[model samples]
Target chain A: MIPVIEVKDVVTHYGSRKILNHVNVDIQPGEIMVVMGGSGSGKSTLLRHLIGLERVSAGSIRLLDQDIGHMSHHELTRFYRKLGVAFQGGALFSSMTVGENIMLPLREHTNLDEKTMAIMVRMKLEVVNLAGFEHLMPSELSGGMLKRAAFARAVIMDPALLFCDEPSAGLDPVVSSSLDELILQLRDALNMTIVVVTHELDSAFRIADRITVLDKGEVLTIGSVDQVRASTHTRIQDLLNRRFEETILDPDEYLARLTGESI
Target chain B: MEHSVHVQPNGHIVSFSGEIDLENSPAARTRLLEVVEYATTVFVDLTAVTYMDSSGIASLVEAYQRAKKTNVAFVLISTSPAVLRVLQMARLDKVFTIHETLEHAQHAKH
Candidate 1:
């Protein structure tokens, strides 16, 4: 099968600093790809590039076999309509009820009337296991409920590609595992390609068919869950074992920085 | 419709068996409504229920509403995992009165 997403020689720089260096990944159709790394590992930057929010300095990103760089503005909009994104913080409009929040995308993109829209919203809520909770405000829900609500909104359109950022963050173990189960269900039920960005090791292993480990602005390894877990690489080992690696200081660079400081 | 109702000293104990789903929820709703109409209080025993889908949940909601409107006390007794999951997902575990055991629900104040 043709890969749903292909990234080749992706180079991204933030002002004078290089953030992503020749990153490459090929995500298969209906696959769950978990991009994981510690802080400042450029995983988030790669996500931004995938979503077309950040411009890559050099590379080609072919989503659904269409090169993102070659697409027109209208083409880009149409391309994005087939994709869904769930942000880390839920990003719900506190003003709207849960039903309205899930219905926002449909209202913006479709011309369905109120009744049809309501039925669709209910169906999506049921998929997320939040049925009969549409009228409640965001503040009325617990943290886990908020995340599920956000997921309901993201899948409202039934996008072929879904990107979830830190889905397990701030959730307890049971709730997190349930959310992971929901992600797998979405993939099976909708034939969706899901890319999850999470630092939670258990959650990643539970959902990911393949995982891409990013470290210091490069792709460390892209492999199956077993391969990534069993690798003997020091950085990957440190990350998997949750061991803190002592930062080795460069004596010459340290002396130069210390001497150059204004005193 | 595969259920039995016993008029206890405090309230009526209604026991439901088999699968309480889309097909039987209508009959369940009809029987449940009848019990809640005359009784001062009703206790739903779902321990023997093999399954309950969303429609079953709706039927219980209807019973709750009927009890609320007619001033009849409504309570759920002895929940099974299959039934409890749907209830909790709908957040009705907080909405409805629940008891750990059928005896507690049966003898407790309505």
Candidate 2:
């Protein structure tokens, strides 16, 4: 099958600093591609390049077999309509109610009437477990609720491609796991290409079909979670092993060690 | 929608018995809300609550949410395994303070 998104040797730079260098990834339709990295590792820059929000300095970016660099204005609009993006912080409109916020994209994109839009809104809310909170203002919501509302808005159009940035950020573990489950369901049910940018290891492993690990503005390693976990590349080993160590250790034992206790 | 409230020196105890279903939910919700208003802590006994549906669950959740908002310690007591299964399925088991018996729930408060 043709890849939904293909990036070959993509090099993105901001001024003199290279944000992404020689990065390559193939995102298949209906699979989730997680970009994993530490802070300032240029994962966001790569996403920006993929969505055509920022141009790559060198190399090729192809979506649906068309080079994004050569797309015309009309073609670009059509291209954007096929994809949905949920930015960090949700980025919802402060002036609009949650229902109105989700309805904006549908209203602008389709000719559905008020009743149809209301039904669509309720359906989307049900998907995200926010069915009755549609009438509530954004200010009335908590952090997790805001994220789910934004997610509801993102999928309102049922785009072919969906991108999420740090979906678990600022969320508790329970809520974060639920959101991961929702993302998995979205991918399975919608059959859309999902690209997630995040540093959370648990969330990444829980949702990713494949992961591209970046370090110092370059592709460190790209593989399934098992391969990445078993990898011996210095950086990958160091990162994965460090987290593994914490999970394996008993907290009380570790604390005792910190207190200089034997055994 | 029968409510039996036992008043003590410190607080009032409200015991919810029988089945909570769509038929009696609204009235039950109203009475439970009112009963929780005067108590420092409210223990809702669900052992005798033989049946519940989504509407019953919604009403119970609303009661719990309201009690939380009002700063009353809400205790869900004697949750039958059947009721616990429903709560667990809905992911509400983690949200509420549930116990196997009324005394166990009361002991937890101390």
User: Which runs of model 2 end up more than 4 angstroms from their true locations?
Assistant: A242-263, B1-110
Docking tier of model 1: it is incorrect
Judge candidate 1 at residue A38 and give its lDDT. 91
**Could you tally the backbone clashes for each prediction?**
0, 0
Candidate 2 clash pair list: none
The per-residue C-alpha lDDT of model 2 at residue A214 equals: 93
Q: Which regions of candidate 1 fall more than 4 Å away from where they truly are? A: A243-263, B1-110
